[model samples]
Target: MKHIFIVSLALLSLCAVAQQKPNNEVSLDALTTETQFSSDSPDLVEFIWWIPNEFWEASFSQDPSISASEAQEIVSLVEDYTIVIALKGKIGVFGGINYEDVDHIQKEFTVTYNGTDLRLIGEKELNADTRNFISMMKPMISNMLGPMGENMNFFIYDNKKSPINVFEEGYIQFTLGDYETGTELPLGSLLQEKQCSVTKKLHNGKWSYCPYHGVPLTNK
Candidate 1:
């Protein structure tokens, strides 16, 4: 735990440095392959191909005291890779297929005084009293600052929508995901445990296949 926090804070300091976004894209092929593979039912890798804080430090930086709009601007820039820090000082790497649409992200995980947590996936209403309570709570929440770990979360989006939201129809939640950062644990572990299955479609009696496990479309 000590080593982890030490590494994390050092990363926070580095990523908080301001710099021009790198022109060159970070290469997935170049990620270090030092992870131990699992020795269980499925051959999933034991370690995550995690984003190193070096990449975030290289991309851009912001002090924890920076404005919300400033932080939003820094995160909105899609480098080949990037890491974003929230106003309250939590950091998460945001990029994937939904690279361009950054609107669905609400950096502050807000809750009403009535206890209605609005960082939720669906439509949640807050009456006037609840709204007022939230306004009152914001400052108190702001002062108790502790940085969440860097590069801990991700967002996936639909390419079809002009701007995508996970709340829309057909969004699949990672079953173990129960936190604002989404999964209580890193998603790589759950994926490695999944039984690779091909989706079969019988459209008008014609059979076609879709695979969910990174399996090949064609199986001989």
Candidate 2:
């Protein structure tokens, strides 16, 4: 009877431990939707994001309290960040955004097939050009929609949403020809002008650095 009792106690302990473990299957929509924007704020975009455990441990940048196996919620500090990286290198442009218009200033915007919901960001209407661009990016975004993957990165939306950024190297081998030879892509040009903070990957599997800011060109 003692042996049976011991075995039963062991099984109960195991069950309790299993139940205490946090769910690895985090809800993407819930995490992303928590980001928000307000008209009364100083800036139109908000810098909020869900940080993974690896990021903390990789640099050990934070205190010992943050561990590799533990995920951090509600991270808002971002530098040199933009929505262009979410394009998956499909196209080189940022048509749906207007830099001068703070509201249009994209804070890590990613392509999505879902209908445009500006209300989430305190906006009543979206620019037509932006709408069309979002439409074009639907398929590309859908191609990589799901839980976090090996090559996927995350972007915070105006501090109100979270979107996965997929890194598909060489996804588009080449373009047939340049549609506009002389005219530069508006977003591409702005990126060069140091107006936006979209990080570019180097050949060494590392991110580029900003000389002026003297920091790594990446979103935090």
Point to the candidate with the largest lDDT. 2
Candidates in order have lDDT scores of 0.27, 0.28
Global fold similarity of model 2 (TM-score): 0.19
Runs with alpha carbons beyond 4 Å of true place in candidate 2:
1-62, 72-101, 106-220
Candidate 2 whole-model C-alpha lDDT, 0 to 1: 0.28
Q: Residue 24 lDDT in model 1?
A: 32
Clashes of 1: 0
Q: For candidate 2, lDDT tens digit of each residue in 28-98?
A: 33323322111222322122232322222232324466554442221122211122222111212542322
Every model's TM-score: 0.18, 0.19
